[model samples]
Target: MRPLKRLVEQFLESEAKGGILLFVTALAAFVLSNSPWAQAYFDLRDVYLKLQVGDWVLKKTLLHFVNDFLMALFFLLVGLELKREILQGELKNPRQAGLAVAAALGGMVTPALIYTAFNYGGEGAAGWGVPMATDIAFALGVLSLLGKRVPLSLKVFLTALAIVDDLGAVLVIALFYTSQLNVTALLVAALVFGFALLLGALRVRSLTVYMLVGLVLWYYVLLSGVHATIAGVLLAFAIPIGRARPLPPHADGVAEDPELHEAQLELLEDAAREAQSPLHRLEHLLHPYVAYFIMPVFAFFNAGVALEGAQVGSIALGIFFGLLLGKPLGILLFSYLAVRLGIARLPSGVGWGAIAGVGLVAGVGFTMALFIAGLAFDAALLDEAKLGVLSASVTAAVLGSLLLWKTAAPRPS
Candidate 1:
């Protein structure tokens, strides 16, 4: 429990920093794209990259590499977090998880319906999945800015809700976004994926083995017309987490004995690390990279939608309204119904206003929304969708943060 608590704190702090960095990168990219160097900015995204292994070759632009390859790591991190929550964190208990689970369902369905309502029978209709996501880092970053003014319960609720939302987004990508399939490639991917899962059941703790299997699974999935990124999630489940044990209150183990030798302290430190599950170790290892490097680079490439001559059409409007209005409406409505029907209850220190505020924050769908927009729309409609996501994300952040700040009850000093 002590280790888990530390991990949670680390996650929150890392996200705050990462969210700020993402803002800076996205702004810089946007400015470059719309400035005199617009051509160069777009060209950078189009820079072709290639890798070959004998008869097998993989080639994609810089944008595709970031989106396809780097983003697989992002999803891997997401999968790890999702697994932790389901196994032992907030989602472990159905009683405690009911409210967040219900709210996440509402968050997903309402936005998709709202987007579909506006773009029904239109070219943009396929992009309904764009608004049905929550950028947890950005949302949690806002809460971090507010400091102790907000209850800890609110943060927990938001985290749980966003994770459930992530799972929904994963499903959407796997089911709806796939294109024409190559049966042979899919069959191979499936068999490889099953073998990886079997490793976990066999209690194999070798990270190297799982990773080797994952690479093969990824290539086959990519060739099968299924998104390769989904392999990240599958790999996550395949990695075996060793037995769980709570670390000491002080990691050094020297805290309790000031006279201990330096060599003894070093041994204690090593023992502490060994006690952690592979999931925890891997998650900690990847957190810094995902937050500081991969995600910001992804933002630089994907968020740079040229604003000049960009027409705001049904796609933009649908995403905007779906994120702004539909997100809050669905969350609040479902949460209220759940509580009223005795299916769920509000957190100890939370109220209707906080719930509403959280629903708005969940509308900060910048990362996943942009990723889905790329999948659902081509060059012609992609810019418009990006515009909608950017505008809605900023609006939701400001509005949600202010509401949470104002409505929060004063806590004891």
Candidate 2:
């Protein structure tokens, strides 16, 4: 139990550090883009790369590769986290989950409405999805800096809210952002995804089998005119999280038989390893890589467009106001409505002040916002989109962090 607790602490610490690294990398990329060497940066971003495996080939620009391939991996991790949370984590409790679920829904809808209002029936209207995301890494990273000033309940609330927000974004991308679908490719992907689910239902435990099957699934999904990242989520849902049982606690005393005690410890550790679900295992294995590498790379590559010649239309205004104003308003209003209607209550040790602060934190939609913007807008409008994302992210981070800093009291001396 102690070791598990320690591991959770270490994981959060590592994630916080990773988020900081992502921010720094993004800042560097943004600076380089606007600098005199902007042409070189743009050239590298636009440079095409190719990979071939026998009869099949994949060729895309450096930016496309990062956004499609790497971000798919990022979404895979997100999907795994979502699964675990729904099954055993904060989302498992119906009452506690209600607040977050409602808040996340409001957060997503409000941002889209705000963006739509500004760009209605215009060329930028498609970008309504731009501000609908909440980057959990960036938001949680800010909370980590507050230490015990923030309550664990508030953090848990935020985590659950972010997970729901991610699921919403995934649906929006799949339903609204897809292109002309290829029927044959769609059929193939559906069949593969179904087979993968059958394998999970049969309790297949070999990681290699799942990965191989997942590669095929990804290929078909990518070819089916759906965003490639949705493949990651579908694969995640297909992976089995086998049933887990709690181990019996040992009596707290010196053992009469030393050898027996040592054996029990070994057996317990082995049980612990085997008891973990494939979903949990994959999530643990992939989180660090996603945090430290994939996300940072995606941010650097996707968020570096020059701001000088940007198309500063209603699209920019829509995104900025959506994130800065709409996110908090939606979250706060919906949450209170839920409470008033007897749907959910505030978590223990949390107040409306903390919820408000968390609402602002939810506005830090950096990585996902940029990714969706890339999908929503074409090259002509990308620079403006990136500008709005970058500016809103920074401003939200400052406001959210400050609000939470004041709302959450410091640890007792």
Candidate 3:
């Protein structure tokens, strides 16, 4: 219980801080895009920035490298979180998982349907997946602002729902957003993946070994026309989940030998403790890397969308309605139906008000939506998707925060 409480506290704090950073980054992007130096702001990406050495060199447009390479680390952290949750978190339990899975499916399907309704049989039809995302950071941040008023069960539900939402986004990218497959590159990627699995089977524990091989996998996947970020997800599955040792029972306050136990009890207790196990240490070591470095860098790169003139046209309308309406509609409707039909029960200590508030918060789809939009189209339609994403995300954030905050007071016991 102590560890669980600490985990929740840390998660909330990190998410709240990330939200503040995101707000500043987005505001800067909007101002820079609309300012007198707009061209310079845009052209900042085109300027050459490289590391030149005798035998090694690296060069890329400022934004291109940030968006592609830096974002991969973000995806890598995401992949790790997904893997951890599937193994040991709320997702590890079937009944606990079912509600979130159903709600996420409803959230995704309804939004796509809504977006399709707006852009069906039109040039911008492929943009339907744009609104089917829920940014976990923003949602968690909103919940954090509500403090102890919001129940722990509600936070868990939101996290579970977002995890499932991410799974859906991964599928959408793999199925619909991919381009012409490059068989040769894909074959190379497969071989690299095979090598990673081979290392895992050999019980390689060093991250450096995986990192070296992962870079090759990342390159091959990038060239394979499958979204490069998916490589991060695939690679995370190969990482080992072995723990170092099990906690031993304390020998204190109990007779060791019954005949002559009191004298030896302290020694037995000292020998039995295994609190600083290898696996526990590893989890602690990795947690900081995932929380601080990977996520913040991802936000800095991906969240900086050039918000120039707001596109309040068909695209923006489609995005806003899809998220604000679709997320809650899907979450509440499917959740209620599941409970009513006896498919799943509402989690203990959570009320409809908390669940509904979380559903609203789940509509804020900043990171994943932007990533999908990039995959769904090139520069031409990219702006339209971005417009939709920005509008819908802002609307979701504002309304979701309000609803959740408003409902955080004393509820029917």
Residue 395 deviation, candidate 1, in Å?
Answer: 0.5
Candidate 2, 143-262: lDDT as tens digits: 898888887678778888998999999999999899999889999999999999999998787777888988888889889999988989998998888745555466233356987888
| Tens digits of per-residue lDDT for model 3, 174-219 | 7898889999999999999999888767767777788788898988
lDDT of 1: 0.88
Query: Residue 2 deviation, candidate 1, in Å?
Result: 4.6
Q: TM-score: which candidate is best?
A: 1
The CA lDDT of each predicted structure is 0.88, 0.86, 0.74
Give the clashing pairs for model 2: none
Model 3 segments more than 4 A misplaced:
48-59, 247-310, 410-413
Candidate maximizing lDDT: 1
lDDT: worst 10-residue window of model 3: 272-281
TM-scores for the candidates: 0.95, 0.93, 0.86
Residue 364's lDDT within candidate 3 is: 86
Q: Which structure is stronger by TM-score: 2 or 3?
A: 2
- The C-alpha RMSD in Å for every predicted model, in order, reads 2.0, 2.5, 4.9
